[model samples]
Target chain A: MDRYAPPGAGSAAGAERPQAEVRVPEIPGLPAGIPDGGDAPARHEGGEGDAAAPEAELTPPSAGDRPAQGKSPFQALTVIGQIEGHVSLPSQNKTTRYEHVLPQLIAIEQDPEVQGLIVLLNTVGGDVEAGLAIAEMIRSMSKPTVSVVLGGGHSIGVPIAVAVDRSFIVSTATMTIHPIRLSGMVIGIPQTYEYLDKMQDRVVHFVVANSRISQERYRELMFRTGELARDVGTILVGRDAVREGLIHEVGGMAQALASLRAMVRQGGRHQR
Target chain B: MLYSIIPPEVVLRPADGPAAVLWEEVEASGARRLILRRDADGRVVIERIISTEPRDYLDPALQPGQPYHPGRRE
Candidate 1:
């Protein structure tokens, strides 16, 4: 049993092997492909039979621990703390997603080595509460932050774009600015209607506060006639969004990294 | 339910796009609050209303309407 004991606190394998296999626990809502808990593989003295042991079986495999399998030149930023996700509410994939990001963002804010944060947006926007919570955390962080809009950053992703110190979007990136939407059972009444208005106000206030744009301008875009196939919002291109004050710039990886570097530099000066 | 007792309507919009509505009117306890979102194709959503007042208002995230805030209890 001692031989199979994990190498470190979280890992099941020891840290002796130059190249090892790692396993991560299953995240509750994420797909099977996304890693769950963090586990690593270690070299064992025994042969075939040891592989069948329960400890080895229980620990899943991790991509990080895999030996150099003739992969392309690697480029990755070490995860300083954690990447939080909240699957409490379902999104497009019918699972509550993005709720966990807030907690992760908070943890990152407190980490000293984090230097900066980068948000990769590809969500269609799930629970507004969860999305806004994560966005607020990102906006409040003293560390420099940057967001890259890829695929789609509709609805909730709008806040995500503004939360960072700087943001970037690929030429093909698309973002939708629409009215706040609600889900669950709804009973129509005057009081209910009133509640809806106030809620919209809150969203507008937050977006205006964090971004370079104004509330009036945002409303105009949200209420656009027909940008979406069947929706009542405008889908702005990278350059168009930047021109409208919704996004800061329109470029790919190079531009994003440059903005991040600038933000990081600014943060360093603030600390001094 | 009674509201903030404001003498006038404080109509404010955040951006120039279609306004996203929030359901539920709770107390504005802190600067940190959650924003809700719906997956593409208008499916699955959740909104938590938090305000620094008695009895929060639970409104739908979509469907255009008026703002719900803390006010006098009826």
Candidate 2:
């Protein structure tokens, strides 16, 4: 019987998890990892008890009882859907090719508990309209917003980075600036040019309005040649993008957080 | 306390356990840092944190019948 006892039993290892479970402080919303029972351990004060409660409680029934195995509750809006992925657009049976972050974005915006949003991007730039739509939603968010470019934030992502209250691009992250593209089409007249012009104007205007850069510089980057394919766009490195004012800073997580915190602080002040 | 900035490498994975939030590694400023954290607002905070310690474990591979991690100390 003694050999059957777990090696870690009866030690600090035994004391750890129960301690967290018992320690749910009186916060309005439950913490991320703690279990559901109000009368668990509540051992620690404001420690992990507060953070762990929600994850333990909110986990779906289908998830089963491996308390240690639940997905962290979006205690803070954890990424629910894939960025630039799909979520059943009303019109299309197929998922949108680009990042259609609307569902989660809407949830975050509607969530009063969600005081801010952070968008992480590493897209190769798919479906322009879809990307732009996501960007617009992020732009209009009442809560503070920040975007961090991971591997890439190309094509439609140009608008996304600027849409946030602030944006960050890691030194290795690459951002491509290109003109609006189209799929197979039939129009070959002056009307085609008009369509292109309007589309181009939309991208330019959105990027310019959201970012600190002027339209002229944005155009220069977009129209620059020898950077992309026969009709693609220019690619900017982290520092170059910042120098061009398309991005606010040539930073990573720290800068992104600082920006978010500032925005949250600012937003808090306004509410008060 | 709030941080003005957090590096992208300080991200804590679910496997590493939970803290005030969960985090993941991201590229930026030429260092391996955290790219995300759950903030007080219930949002995935992309800011950096001051500590890189493995605070809590959100291990997904724990026993099914178990309702909690073995001795999960906050």
Best by DockQ: 2
TM-score of each: 0.53, 0.53
lDDT of each: 0.45, 0.49
Q: What RMSD, rounded to one decimal, does every model reach?
A: 20.8, 17.6
Q: lDDT tens digits, residues A89-207, model 1?
A: 11102122332344445545664545666777765554456556667877777777777788667666677677777777887887777765443336577887677677667667777
What DockQ does model 2 achieve? 0.05
Put down candidate 2 lDDT per residue, A82-160, tens digits, no spaces.
Answer: 2222222111011222221455566566655556666676655544466677778878877777778877777666787
Give the runs in model 2 whose Cα sits over 4 Å from its true position.
Answer: A1-100, A183-187, A268-272, B1-74
lDDT of model 1, residue A250: 86
Worst 10-residue lDDT window, candidate 1 chain A: A72-81
Candidate 2 docking classification: incorrect
